[model samples]
Target: MNNAHYELQDGIAVIRLENPPVNGLSYELRRGIVDGIKKAEADDNAKAVVIIGSDRAFSGGADITEFNTPKVMAEPTLPTVINVLDSTELPVVAAIGGVCMGGGLELAMGCHFRIAHPQTQVALPEVKLGLLPGAGGTQRLPRLIGIEYAMNLIVSGTQVPAAMFQGTPLFDELVEGDLLESALTFAKKVVEEQRPLKRVRDMKVSHPKPEAFFLWAKTSVGAVAKNYPAPLKCVEAVKASIEKKFDDGIKLERELFAQLIQTPESRALRHAFFADRAAGKISDVASDTPTREINKVGVIGAGTMGSGIAINFLNAGIPVTILEMKQEALDRGVAHIKGVYEGRVKKGKMTQESAEKKMGLLSTTLSYDDFKDMDLVIEAVFEDMGVKQKVFETLDATCKPGAILASNTSTLDLDKIASFTKRPEDVIGLHFFSPANVMKLLEVVRGEKTSKEVLATSMKLAKKIKKTGVVSGVCDGFIGNRMVGKYQTEALLMIEEGASPQQIDKAIEKFGFVMGPIRMADLAGGDIGWAIRKRHYEEKPDTRRLYVADRLCEMGRFGQKTGAGFYKYEPGNRKPLHDPEVDRVIEEVRKEQGITPRKISDQEIVERCVFALVNEGARILEEGIAQRASDIDIIYLTGYGFPVFRGGPMLYADEVGLINVERALQKYRKQTGNPFWEPAPLLAKLAAEGKTFN
Candidate 1:
């Protein structure tokens, strides 16, 4: 019931923040801190006040639950609470441990003294949410530490250990012992010595060559600020700490925070922040559902995907046994994993001893017998159904009774794959993105018959392996690929209609995609999309054709692997070069189709490609393929290189306005005469009602 507890011991008053998970400095906690300080002031015997929190967190930051609500800016706001602590006559000591960040650090700096655990994670992470620290963080931090360190910490939103600031005024003492004990002893000393109540606001912040330094900071931050304006604003706010008085700096910080939060870029980043957390929850599955243990993992095949999957388990300290059809293949897989660890070692990302320890958890096998003891077996074999069927059949017979049988199939029918095993309830799809170990997405495909227990465990395992697992119902290509198909198709169609591959790619990249679809196709190997299209041509005879892509593949131009596709690459260099041959090929296809090429604007290119994804994502949401609109955003943001600032295609569509999106779809549908451009029913409905997806 009490968010903060008040106690008195030997003339010392202690205010212990009691919010669980993380003392997030909620209104209640803020009031409690103020009330405790008041109580300390009133007590004749209380000589000093000590503020503390649990070892897990002195405070993580602002209470995210209160975000976007009036509660966040209610009376006794973070600044008000900090101001209370700052003006208090008695010396206040902040005993910080574990995580203390954002307004939490601001609160600590408001105190007269700070004693922290050496490993306490300290940060002013508001810039990550597209805002500067609004509560004296920029003003006080530069005063405690130098301008340079404060600039880096506030702008980057990166966490540094308290030990890193050992000799700095940020932490009066870095304690390796019990935090509260050190704080109580320090408070006693402060009382005995009658120490002055130090205020960070009174401290001066100076920077040599202030104008030149700030000019360089702006230029450096500008280069990476991209579509997000928060980083540069952060620089401005930090510079103000030196240029302006303390209260004036605080006012400037508030102004910048307000301006940044209202920007579309900041809104998108905030949406993405919430969307990632939302993806981890499954509505039908209770949070308390029991999950099966996955102490040992078995990975089928020894190719790139399989080896990468095995490395995830090995890195998680879970023993992984990789099965390959041949000993030579097994040897190559093992060697590839070793080389990856060796690369990390050489780069100093990890020590050789640590790499060796991870490798020690990895073992190779030639048969399924080794999988019997595996609690979870993931098959990363060929994507063909026949190949998957055989792997599932073998695993069905080989793995133990409760073992989770997962397939890393990207587009295959998960239900059919599950049918290969009698225990269909245990079969689920753990679709890892390419370079499985590197990419963050893991689409946990929940089949028609997947048990709740298995689904819960699969989600848990995804987190354990450090992947953003988004749940998807059974559907061809599931969520990410299904939407990406439309995205890439629009790009190809634009090329057919006259836009160059480079032009289309540049437009999308300019819109903030990590890579353009045409360049992405080249990087992913054009043959892969060509093969899928061939399958589509057979399965859906009336499917819209992408002739130019097929013609390029017909010429044996796969991608970077084949030294050419839509673009050519120099040996040992991944940069794609302009291939005049590809231009000629595009012309030939256009002539064959009797299509007249028209110059397309970059705006058209971006809208067509991005809105194509938005329309398909609408359909996916309508069909219940994706749990919510945000899940689609998460999949695209993490796996498909959708711009985080745009909050992925779905959220971007909402930001663009559903009615506007519907209008664009109608315009493109008529202009292009492509049936795929037709607005999805849900999109039209939402637009008619003037509602957003999220």
Candidate 2:
């Protein structure tokens, strides 16, 4: 059957696109559309043409699978298809609903008139994939929606509801319901009125004082768009629309779009887009695996982590029962949850009623009996094994049969925790990032005996709470923290070798990290890492005990909580300030070790810290802790604030050429004489083979 079907109704020829899901405009669909339009033009009884899509989408732009392929530019390309629609003698009206984006929107704008359902979302999100709209979107959107508004939508790649643009020329009319009937009524009226065929290309695009407006826009867009070239290209395209003829403007748009598609930044962004989707798939679990229902959740402990975890379930409209040993701790946790809602209400993000409704799902308790009926119970107690084991043992005994037992432990052995429960298959790790309510990453650590249903259900639940869930196999620190451990270790070692905290932070920040390791450590609390390190030292006796971190802990500098960490903080101020006393301590520690400090270059610092991550990530790949290299990238890009433009560490290493990365590690291995600098076997082998992790 043809992807697009042509049918006549009451003197109006309706063209319905039949491609499943979002009807991606491939060559076949493009041909079908062109044929539909010609059939309407040829039909003696048909007075008008109405082009639309399946209930799901009008068109979701060009078929991405056809990208960089000859079929994309085959007979009747997107531009050629749009041209045929524009030339049709009948009044062609676009009936848009669901998703209309990129070339889809461009196709709609090519028609004589456009209308959509009220809730339909419209966007030209090509910029998000590191390319501007190639199909006259830059030129036509401004003509219909004004220069400033078009620039905002095109540059930021934001989605807007069709209702928001009711008065704009982009939409001829918005139907309440039954789009076909309303469109038929609209088309018949157009026939009666003898409405002339209109084209977006014929419309004049104008901006008030074009030269001055463009100048101001360039300066503002340039400020936040240092790394991305597409947004600025979007600016230049829109600017050309205002200055040049319509045909010239579109020519400029196509040129800029083609150029961006080939750039490395665009390639990285495209890779990131695919990586995020691929992260959700587990190799062992089928996509059709059944997930257990999750209605009620129980959180053990009412500390910061527990409270944050509870808020996620509550926000998802799932009832949450939080258990704490003391009423004081429970009160504080409950109050913090309320305070969060109150803050959102004050910020105008949520109404008082909505906040109350979300808070209504929350309850606090002092007994595990309160969790007897919960579908899932997550223990967010102390990170120590003994405490977690005890909590899980009690939960396994208390929670009803088949209930999932989860631990929010960041760095402990998940398999050991799972063993504590009688039903090991039900025990999994839901490693939410700190301040769980805000962060998107949820590392669903699957134990050795974890059932496929439990893994599938945990992933489903993660989605309900609006998190990007990545599955991890049993291992210390799992995916994110495991790699971050190396990143942090290198930073501490770098500081000891003479790079100051501020200099190290600045160098990484310049390289695209949100915060340097030192600043992030200060924010997360230095004590957290100190405890983890102590565990490591115990597990592996050869681990160093007297690092610079231990000295900072001994000085009672925990982090933002203590107001003095590696860097000092004044009362009520969380910003790090240079402390000469800390410098003195570093010098004293260096003198005690009988080693003189030497100046370290920023390049060396980046190599040490980043190469540490790459090497550890390589080991993770070999061990099957992560499903693929892209999964590791997803963990870092979403959780650890890895630079999006450079892609993730694994991709970044591949881009840097594994040979160069191997050379860098070999250099550090020889120069620093630290066993940590030794290259992973996988990294060395890949470098030798001239291959990438991807």
Candidate 3:
């Protein structure tokens, strides 16, 4: 298909890119632009040139599909095409609208003049993929705009509307009408007056006390850069445009861009970019599947989870009705949700009127009859199966016909819950993470009888509430929590074997996790997991085992709420302070098991925790609980605080080599006579065959 098209308008040669969706500059598109420029320059009748794109997008960026392919560096690259456009004799005007970003913005910079609509979103966001702009973006952008503005834009990879730069030289005019017509008129004015070529390359990058500002910028960028190097490199490249000559800065930009592309951080970030996009697609569900309209939502229970769940739909502009057994309980739930919004208002993150508007969408009830008008009803009651069955059965009888009934059960069986209702197809799970309005993950649990329309609508509603929706087959703990169960188990086992909570947390934190399992357990409250563990033992008797966590709950120390758990916390501070009493509890458990404590290394702690996630993830894949390896990565990255720089646990395992992982598991099995360390069959097979999950 023709990615770029050329047409003649009066005496102006108009070149427009036709790549559907986003007009990514591919090899063919580059060739078209280069050839079109040459054709326009050769024709004496064409006194000027105008370039434009469709209303949705002028261009988003370079065609990432061409990355690492011969087509990317194939002759007539983006720079080559831009160079010809920059040096063209006929005056050219860039007409920008929608999303014009990265290489697209770079191409616009090459034109003699630019005209855009006020709402045009313009950005150079290569920094998000862990690389600087390779094709003259860092060099030319600073020359057109000032160096400081260029630094902030390139470093953050943030979008700025064309109107934000209205008075700036980056755009010659802002057109509210047809951008193409305005651009053509701008081109005619340039030709009528015979305006000299206004190439961005000839412009100078100015700054007051350049050396001083760069010194400050380096220190600032370095502080926030953390494990990622691309942001700092972005600052350096923009600095080069000011310190070095323009051509020399271009060379340095290429060198820095090439260096960053090879880093593991860059590879992981690129994987993340693709994984997030791929997670939304369910292969079995066709794109044309009709979704149920969720105009109103209902939530049962007035506890933390249910209240938070109501806040999500309310924030999404959907009216929410929450039910409780008593009027006081209902009032408390409403107060908590309102307090969250009020806090946002006090923080200046939202206006008082805006917060009130959102809170106004919420309603409370004491009877199931009020849920009759709700298009969807989510039960966020306790984790007990009996409670869930009662809720589902009542919802089954009381809800309006065609209403989607969803359970917010994190680890419970969705299929069994579906069995409580006659229309099992309408019953699915919308597992929102803790503090639902704040966290991004929404694991849409698909039961055995879940209809495609229901599953699709749940995913759609997830996006409506600003959540990253990942579909998971009905299973105990679903995907994120199921894998985390194993991960936490490793931490517990390591503690029993010898390592202290601080030691394990330190090793994992150094490995890049923000919160270690022990600290996470404490923050979430040990009583939560203690209850879950009790439930596990009740449901599956054979897996019953005594552990140190039960001791913490027995002492009535439940995380931040109780001011103590595995660690002690000072009144206001949430920082974990080591407790010898907790260590004594662990020591007593080890003595009860008739085992002596052994010295454990940080490497073992890191391996056992991360590999535990990997092993369960493999089993999940083989069981078809997760769609693909990348989808699992997305779940962990978004839901849990798995380090983004390592991709997800599955991708990290692939990076570590599955063979090495199997060997480590075998070593642990031999060290401790536990059958749980046995390598998953899928993992062992993949390792032997030399394969990656992705």
Candidate 4:
């Protein structure tokens, strides 16, 4: 069946787009629109034409599922359908409501006239997928609106209300209510008045100081989009609008779009986009699984992590009761929560009243008694098993039956944590990244004993709190932390050999990470890693110790908190400055180990660090710790600041070719003689078979 419905309403030919859930313009939908336009043109009873969609979306643009598929470029493509609309002699009015983005807006621009709901969200967000609008968006948008406004919308990929374009030629009318009625009336009026076919291509586009403006735009966009080439291409496409004729401008836009599609940056972005969506789906857990209600939440501890966790639920409008051991600690936690809201208000992100309203949902106490009625209780106490045991035992005793007992443990085993509670079935892990309120990733650890209902509820709650929840089976560090351990180990090993912290950081940062491993370690606090290493010493004595990091901890150069780490931080400043003292310490440690310093290449640094992650990730996939390779990618993308333009380690390895990655691992193994440098079985097998991680 066609994805559109055509009918004669009054005297207007109404062709309503019927693709549900944002109405992505898939091939079938594109074909339906083309057929409807033909039918409208042939009908004698129809006065004019109106194209409409559901209340949720006018159209959300090209179907992502169809990307990299032949169906995306099938006959009657989005551009072809829009060409039909442009050619039609009869007045075609786009009655847009809800989301009208990318090709949807491009399609609307092709029509004779346009009317939209004031609240409709409009954008050309193709830039986010490392692309410019390929279907006449660049050529037509500047013709409707000015160059500056159109360029800003396309390059930034931000959404704005359709009302923002009310006075512009982009919208003929902005209706606040009953969009269909207004559209039909507008269509009839167009017919009665014999309005000429108003194609956007016929309109003139001009800009003041066009040369200067485009030059500045290119430079600015280039700086912001340092690694990715699409944003700069977007500027070029927009520049073509005024520099060339309409058809010629569209040709340039298509050429640039095609070039970007072939780029690895664009490929990686598309992979990440699909991987993010894939991460939410569990193979064994049915999408329609019933989830337990989580209306009231109880948080144990009032430290930074605990407070951040509470803020998330409070922001989501859930009532929270935060418990602490002492009243002073409780007061401090409450103050921290208040300060966060106050800061938001000060930044003009929210109203003071709104902040107060959210804070009003918080209840602070020093007793487990307050958690009796909580639907869910998450313990964000110290990451000690003994402390966790006490907290869970108390929560199990105090919380109402069936209340989910979740632990906010980053590295501890979820199964062991579940064993602490009597209702192990109600236990799950909700591992929030540092600064929990702002981070996007939440590893929803599905313990062996965790009920499907509880697991589903945790996933649902992750979405409710606006987090990208990637499910991980219980392991020492789950997926992200486990892989990162190997990544950090390689970085430390490089530093010990010859590479300075600065060189290692710059290499990885250049490789597209937001921050380098050494900088991240310093910012996160050297003490934290030291503690983890101490534990590793007891648990796995055979594991090699990172002596340099241990020596730094001994020096009490904790991090930004203590004002000194691998690099010195000036008071109130986060910039990492070179310290001669740090260099001296490194040299001393190297001497003690009877190791001679040798120059290491940046390429070697990047490979050792990133490949370490890929190797561990392969093991993670083999062990089923991560359900799929894409899930691991999501963890790194959302949690670990992995470059979105390189996809994630797994996909990056695939792009690098697993054979090349295995070769690099072998090279490292022979040079370093480290057992950990060995390629994972999965990686080796995939390389041998000439298969990708996918």
User: Residue 557 in model 2: shift from native, Å?
Assistant: 0.9
After aligning candidate 2 to the native by TM-score, how far in Å is the CA of 125 from where it should be? 1.8
Deviation (Å) of 574 in candidate 4: 1.7
Model 1 / residue 246 / CA error / Å: 1.0
Model 3 off-target regions past 4 Å?
67-69, 544-546
For 444-476, candidate 1 gives per-residue lDDT tens digits of: 999999999999999998899999999999888
Global lDDT for candidate 4? 0.91
Candidate 2 residue lDDT tens string, 1-694: 4678889998999999887778999888899999998898889999999998866898999887777689888988888888898888889999998989889999999999988999999999999989999988999999999999999999998999999888989998998888888888888988999988888888887766888999999999999988999999999999998889999998999999889988878988988888887888888899999999999899988888889999899889999999999999999999999999999999999999999999999998998888889999998888888898788888888989989999898989988988887899998999999789988889999999999999999998888999989989888888889989889988888778888989999999999998899999999998999999888898899985547888998888888889888888999887889988778878888888876789999999898888899999999999999989998888888888888888889999999999999999999999978887789999999999999998
Candidate 4 per-residue C-alpha lDDT over 1-694 given as tens digits, one digit per residue, 9 for 90 to 100? 7998999998799999998898899888999899998898889888789999989999999888788789988899888898999988888999999999999999889998999999999999999999999999999999999999999999999999998888999999998789899999899899898988899999999987999999999989888998889999999999999989988998999999999999999988888888889888989889999998899999988989999999999999999999988999999999999999999999999999999999999999877888889999988988788888888888888889889999998889888888877899999999989899999999999999999989889988998999999999888888998889899999998899999999999999988899999999998889888888899999998989899999989999987888999999999999999999889999999999998999999999999989999999999999998988989988999999999989999999999999999999999999999988799999999999999997
TM-score of each: 0.99, 0.97, 0.97, 0.98
Which sections of candidate 4 miss by over 4 Å?
Answer: none
